[model samples]
Target: MILGWRKRRIARHAGKKNPPGNQEMELVIPNHFRCPISLELMKDPVTLSSGITYDRESIETWLEAGNFTCPVTNSMLRSFDQIPNHTLRKMIQDWCVEKQNYGVERIPTPRTPVTPIEVSEILFDVSASSLDVDQYRCLELVQKIQKWGAESERNRRCIVANGAAAVLAAAFDAFSNDSVERNVAVLEEILSALNWMFPFDVEAQKSLGSRASLGCMIWFLSSKDLSPKQDSIVALKELLACDQKLVEKLSDFEGVNEMLVEFVKKQICPTITKASIMVIFYMVSVAYSSSEKIKLAFVKMGLVSLLLEILVDSEKSICERALGVLCGLCSCKEGREEAQSNALTVPVMVKKILRVSDLATEYSISTISELCKYGRRDEGKILVEALQVGAFQKLLLVIQVGCGDKTKEKATELLKLLNPYRAGLECIESVDFKNLKRSF
Candidate 1:
């Protein structure tokens, strides 16, 4: 009787006609054979505790996204465990085989999902392996973690939840002072693993913020290879954002500022460039007293010129941060002098005004104001440069369009400074005429 029923079902599928000019026939799949979550033929049908059957992969993804309720039923789930619906699976497979000539392919049995316990064991293997004694094994374990993370979002989250990030951080911290040549491959793998598991948990962040870890990152910043350098800067940026105290300590590290300046000069990639700029900004914009020292150190490294160069064609976020760092550096005497000496300073600042963002506009105006107020030589020339670069008109636009009170105040002051220089310049004639009409 079962064979007869199967043969009749196959004949029914075979009788379906192909649409005109089409080479293949569309199979009419049964509604009950499809997963509620995916609306597709269920390859590995699993019944949830809520009595809902779905494709295992689809439901797992749904649950991973923080939804605990049954998607279709809208009922609370008593358990996350999904029981395999063997009868439904057998039916779906039989249907697909019957419609094989109509472009339907049988689904292969899905592999078992990775468990948290399995991820924990991998992390344990990574922790037990030592780069100094067993570099090959260490690299292998770290690479396995990286491979798992790359396979699926669920696996990455699983690895991270099992403390992969913290383990890699501790490994990096432990070998931070070792020679780069001896542990370069292992270190790079560890960095790759950590990069894959970003937005590190609190424990991971704390581990990455240790003194040895900071030193390790500084060493990577100086590496001849670009990948590790990029990874290191990104990690450092995250650490600084999480732990404000690291900013102060990082500033005290000798040659760190110089390395960061060099990294910006290289401009390997936008992500790395932004990270390096932000790290520098944090170091130079800490507490006021120490900030001055940090600013001086960066200015001495020719950060002023570097910032101006960055401002020329940088994207919005990079431009804002570069301008911010410039503003901080300009607060010190040496920084202001360094900025004023750069030929691009006034024109770049002027061009940036009212162009990138409100914050960028404010920083540009503020930096130019500092130059005009404190420039030992050619304050008039700086004003003249401002006039020539359409600074006067942009500043006027900034005021008319409205901005924060501090920005508006700076614009007003800048306008007053540039007013005397606007006499013969053609750009200001309209403003002067408007003023004359108002006075009358």
Candidate 2:
């Protein structure tokens, strides 16, 4: 009976008929349309500028809507400008093909944009004078705004977004060098608001969540005297769960993806879908402490492939961020050997290092210096070479004219790392260093 049921299920799959493992999957088209360029599928179907026969209704629609490119070839298609007749004919002949064996035809459907929610008007009532309120008090004020944001009235709810941002700024103000509990409390409150806000109005929901999440991160990571405790862990778990749901609903948003990546690196949550983010985050945090447990966890999570992917991505911003995190992870106590064994560190530097922008270049250099302070001599030497005299000269130029005092301090430290004796002599020459040494 079970075998009969299974066979029936397989048989019912429209036009999907092949023997066992070799079964051909049916291509379901919203309309009976196929791209002439890539004959197999009509995904994101679009048309070209050529007055050609290859265009489908879906392609024509996409072209009219101003997305004039073929999905398969990524070739430029229809524009406000006219397509030449020769180009149109060639595309039509090449892209229009029919597969007789395939049994499903798909119909194209218009995509509906998710409606935004009305935020509470009370949120906007906050004055610049109120920006200095206590964290919990600020949170409470925002809570009422969030409550009113859920109202059916559109204008009433629009206020919640501004309230959310105000509350975020206040939360940052409230965070101190020794306030883990307060930080967790702020995040918890924001997460609660986010959970309620996202389902109805995605824009307001995203706006509120983005500011809160970023603020929470700054407070949590920058705290010199606070670390995660049990309650903090629970709060992080809740936030992760909420973010996971949001990611599922809105995978198209890059901000969501970036924040998800940032959180996974900072907080080690043991969920499955965020496993990729977790591994990358873990590797990056390793520079602070080479905890074997974290290293082992990364191994178990299978991060080797993902790290390699980040190393190879063409985006300079992404590459820099990934490399910063990976370099930190690679310098952990047992991380150097593990990184070498798995071959995660070298190939990444080779492909990505030179391509990074000036600011990122400085960060990468500084990170390598920090790594060298703990990593094997050979690895350290490689980092030192990258910060050679000429590189240091360029870095100095950036510090003198382009960067602020903070960047200058980092540049000074990197110079120290490159040549400690000279750095020490220079430090002795400075009144600030003399005072700093005296204080110590």
Candidate 3:
């Protein structure tokens, strides 16, 4: 996706000639004349299934990004058949000709979109038995076709119709143990193509869930090699998200938790970190209730501390997932104890309340609620520690500014419970602090 953006950016710059010189130089293209997707003058204009029209390349890029609806109308695109707006194309061309002295370039006609027969032939070659040595070429063709599908939902459905996903999965299984570095690179491309398909074609992931394929995933993640690691994370996240049963089966694999922990702690790529956090959250959240050791296994691997580190600078998504894992861990006796025991746990948790997002707010409030409500081992110390972190201030504000009914209720209850300890706090101007003031 990033590469596509980079290509488009270069094309845009390459398309533009130098700015128009001072002919009252409002050198800007008029808004009505612009491509909605690219904001450039329309070239080879084409109308989508919706009534709106855009430059051919711009609209195709949107579709390739896996967008299903018309970017303008949000209408579900009925087909990838982007009909050429011949009238608009001529008008754009005429305008460019009129502005030739102003440095405008003539728009060229776009090539036709890839046909189904072409995609079919590629799929047939992949499925054919003629040459095992030519697997790399076949994989490259699949990647291009998947990318073409990204151009529009119509093209994507075409690729799927031609069995692009099944072929990619088969390729992964075929190359699972090929120790040749070149083969590993091919597997990475195949994995990435699968990642792009995940949002649309989930059944394709079943091929990747096999023991042999999973073993390769772990090997890539654990190995020091950096290039394929991000794709590995994306593939793993999709696989885990699609199959809850897979979550249960993961306990049999060794070092999976530890490997994901290293990814988060290393803070390699934001996407990598986010993906790793989600897989960890799914594993612990889905599996820990049935097994005692799974939740504690996270604690043993320094999961609590690692999550705290992620919370320090990570974005809202990462924050939400980290809190989720903490929630699962805190459900247990040791899990709760480990969270409160961490120095940053209470301070950061309290600070997060209304800060990142509403979801983050929910998990933040829930975490503190666990500490205050279930701080059974050291209830007094837990409440005091929370109070010291300005939990009383934040909770009162939660009630004042308000949140979802569930979150507000939890906050109100915690505030009422801690009311006896509130005295110098300024935000608690309400009656909730009356009892706590007397105690102080």
Q: Rate the local accuracy (lDDT) of all candidates.
A: 0.79, 0.42, 0.73
Of candidate 2, the 10-residue stretch with the lowest lDDT total is 431-440
The parts of candidate 2 lying over 4 Å away from their true place are: 1-292, 299-305, 340-359, 379-440
What are the runs in model 3 whose C-alpha is more than 4 Å off?
1-22, 25-41, 45-101, 105-109, 129-134, 146-163, 177-182, 200-202, 288-291, 399-402, 423-440
Query: How close is each model in CA RMSD to the real structure?
Result: 7.4, 18.1, 8.3
Per-candidate TM-scores read: 0.77, 0.32, 0.73
lDDT of 2 at 369: 49
In terms of lDDT, model 1 sits at 0.79
Task: Write down the worst ten-residue block by lDDT for model 1.
Answer: 1-10
User: What lDDT tens digits, residue by residue, belong to model 2 across residues 1-440?
Assistant: 01111123344546555577745443443232334643433433333455333333345445557775655567765453322234433333343333223432233331221122323333333333234444565566556655554543332334433344443334433343225364566554544454333232333334334534434543443334233222222333334334443322233223433434444444344332233343344334433333455454444444434555555643564555555555555555554545444543443443332346555555455444445555655654544443432344444444554454655676676666556433322211122112111111
Winning model by lDDT: 1
**Residue-by-residue lDDT tens digits, candidate 3, 1-440:** 11111112222446654444521343556675788888777766888778798987788779888999988888898997789888888887887777665556787765566677988887777656213745567667766766786766656666777667776776676677444255676676677776666652454567677776787777778757676788888787888887867776666788887888888888888888888988888877784344558788888888888788778877778888898888777877788888888888877887777677778878888888888788867766766767776788767666666578999889988888777765653232243233232211
Prediction 3 global C-alpha lDDT:
0.73
Ranking by lDDT: 1, 3, 2
Of the pair 1 and 2, which is ahead by TM-score?
1
* TM match of model 1 to true structure: 0.77
